[model samples]
Target: MMEGTILTGARIFDGERFFDGHALIAENGRVKAIVPEAEVFGASDVTKLDGGILAPGFIDVQVNGGGGRLLNHDPSPETFFVIARAHRKYGTTALLPTLITDTSEVTRLAVEAAIEAAKADEGVLGIHLEGPHLAPARRGAHLAELMRPMDEEDLDLLCRAAGEMPVLHVTVAAEQVTPMQVERLTKAGVIVSLGHTDCTSDEATRLFNAGARGITHLYNAMSALSHRAPGLVGAALDAGDVWGGIIADGHHADPTALRVALRAKRGPGRLFHVTDAMSLVGSEDDSFELNGRVVHREPGEVCSKLVLENGTLAGSDLDMASGVRFGVQKLELSVEESLRMASAYPAAYLGGEKERGFLKLGCLADCVHLSDDLRALRVWMAGRVR
Candidate 1:
């Protein structure tokens, strides 16, 4: 016999689909059973959440920084947990602390820190190495001075450090990485995402042929969808198996482009949302420094002096729930679809569906209890809401 608590009468988002069930039993951080409302039993304690929606805790794959600490600047073990904890309050239960393109030493340190952080904390999933081996033209916030050619020794170190943590993402410029290198990385369980490149359609197709499974931030750091050339966007749209993440905060990409992606991909499973946030996330202090430049935040925008002398667009201050809110309320997507983008879609992206991403039997008891307006009511990292 097993005993824990029952979470009942709430909307549940399973990995593949949303289902309405009665109760879920979780003990010692793992789900024990999922029973209908009437059949729920064998629990000494219960929390009946009738009006709230219970879904998988959000999985953020490209978080650059949070809580006023930048990942690129610190790259320390503590920074990883700081980012995760800050996002957790906003319903992100798991996340990959992302590093922008930088020197070999900085990259190596970030990787080591991420590996160590994940070993120590349940919410620190891993590191997302987003550059240093990328085209200089599409390098968004990445320091161009650090961009370099793909070297075997550096690649090996990344692979060895990540081990079998389950979600190691390497975003390389499609035109820059050799096919053999891409193949080797893919075979080693690293998800190859195409980004920060100006690859032609044919070149993009060749990279996809070599097992590139994802496109980073969709239209932000890549070649656009030209009518004649089509580029990486065309290749990704045409490929059915590829899953993509977008910064749907209405700043990274336009709403029409998101609409096209949602339609072409047949829904939100392929078109998930990411924050791509900076240090300003969860901070009310309006001003901060990034790479020695001043950044100011106003209503609905974060601007950097480096990007534009007066006020140019900067990385977002958005959270997972806000991303969902922008998608549904601003982008005109369905509530169910937007919620899927926030939770289940990204789970499927990193192949975390089976264990960590949704509320189902045999999965880890990670869930988010949200209010009517999509605000996070409570967050459960494993089973116990914090």
Candidate 2:
């Protein structure tokens, strides 16, 4: 019989709201209960935390790399492990190892790596392919030469891969991927998101209707929102069934713009935080190569940015915790909402809400204990402290 371990002393955020004076009980790699702290007469262990917030571990859907490992550099299970382990330190218990625009051979290897990684580690949720099918004009840091329209072979490969993995999120431009392709991918259980496009609002909405449920890194690498045009940005904000991921590091988007998006966004779909993190995170290295270009991290007192040689903003040097902090401190969002954006919103977006993104009874005991300042103090994956 597995004995329950009671985690007490900190306020618990059970995905939706806070529970004061409650204790989280874990047993057999799942949440057993959320009982009152005074009633925590556990059969086995009791770990008392100091002060802070205890919330569900963050689930990042778009992680390019971490811990000096880029998925594109080495699309293997070992690289997945390294990246997962690196972000785990920052309260991310689960994430999709994202691959930037790469060759078809590399993409196949990454899919295989992700499948293998998920079998061994519950933290590896699946894979996100952020395109070889993007528009050149909005191809922020992705290689332009490699970008192309999706072919029949590409569609077949993606549909097959989606069947084998837990999640297969692909970012494609409306200009490159047809609505029929998007519908086919969505039917195959692939989460199709729009990005790196210069599509109009009507074009974006047509794809959204066809089954693209997400907008990648809203307002960046996509068409801008104009009063007359109302581009992809406007389409994302107006659509009630679409979720958008934003890099809240204050570099990819302005604080005011983020704040306005938060309020302007419709329901059934919400904006969530995605680090879009790179290999620089959890590593001492200041620079790394992306598609043969040297990307450097511009360090700052509050935040840092990774940029290419020509100064195009590349992936971010952010972690889940720091993003949550930025939401509360900069965006004026409540701590509960900020934490939900990191944990619940993304999990819901990934369609894994029931098993993840909550501290409810019977949910996976993947959790993070954050200090008052929102730094991760301790983490637990599957009821085991890591």
Candidate 3:
């Protein structure tokens, strides 16, 4: 039998709300209960945690790379452990290793890597395929040479990958991928997201109807939400039932526009932040290569948003901790709301509401201990100290 350990006397955020004078009990590497400090039975094994906020560990759905390695450049599941281990220290308990548009061979290797990591319980939830199927008009940093229209073979590959992995998130241009392709991917248990497109509201809506659950980095790559045009961004905002991800970095989106999206977004379809991070996170390196293109930070620039030598915006270098802080300090959101976006919102978005993202009874014992200033002081993932 496994004996339970108690972490007591801290402010606890149970994913949905906050509480004081509460302690968590973990047995067999799973959360057994969250109870009042006094209600916690007399146990010799109780450990007192320093004063701070205890919140559910964050779940990041889009992680391009970390620990000084880009997933696309390295393209291996073993490297995924390096990425996950790096983010784990910063409060992310679960993550998706995203691969940008690449060759068919590279894509296949990534999928295989994800499957192996998932099988090993490496904190990797699945893989995110960000495209070879994207709109050229909104391709952003994805190489145009590698992108093309989807075909029958492409659909089959995606379907098979989904069947093998625990999660397979596909981000595509709504207009580039037909309703049939979206339907097939959705039915195969893939989480289809809209991004890198120029689809109008109507065409985007058809994809939504086809079970597109979310939008990737809203208001950045896709069509803008204009009063007259009401393009992809407009459709995502109007539909309150779909989740949307935004890059909270100042360069990626202005605060005013982010406020509009946050306020306009309705429930079930709430907005969350994604780092779209690159290799610089968890490392001191300032530059990296993506498919033969050199990407790095600009001089005198303090942010982690990277750019190519030719000035195309490459992936971001923001991590989960920086993203959460930006929500409170810059976005003017309450700490509770900010924490929710970092933890509960993404977990709920990924459909892991009760089990993985909360500190309730029977939930996974994954949480972060934040200092008064909200930095990650200590982290608990799956009932073990990280």
Reference-based TM-score of each model:
0.92, 0.98, 0.96
Collision pairs in model 2: none
Q: Which whole-number lDDT from 0 to 100 does residue 278 have in model 2?
A: 97
User: Candidate 2: what lDDT?
Assistant: 0.92
Better of 2 and 3 by lDDT: 2
Q: What is the TM-score of candidate 2?
A: 0.98
Ranked candidates (lDDT, high to low):
2, 3, 1
How many residue pairs clash per model? 0, 0, 0
Which scores greater on TM-score, model 1 or model 3?
3
lDDT of 3 at 14: 87
**Can you give the lDDT of residue 119 in candidate 2?**
83
Query: Residue 279 of model 1: what lDDT?
Result: 73
Q: What is the C-alpha lDDT of each candidate?
A: 0.78, 0.92, 0.85
Best by lDDT: 2
Per-residue alpha-carbon lDDT of candidate 2 for residues 1-386, written as tens digits (9 for 90 to 100): 22677798999999988989988999888999888877865445888999799999999999999999999999999999999999999999999989999898998889988888888875998899999999999999999888999999999989998888788999999989989999999999999999999999999999999999999998999999999999999999999999999999988989999999999999989999899999989999999999889999897534698999889999999999999999999999999999999999999999999889999988999999999999998899988899
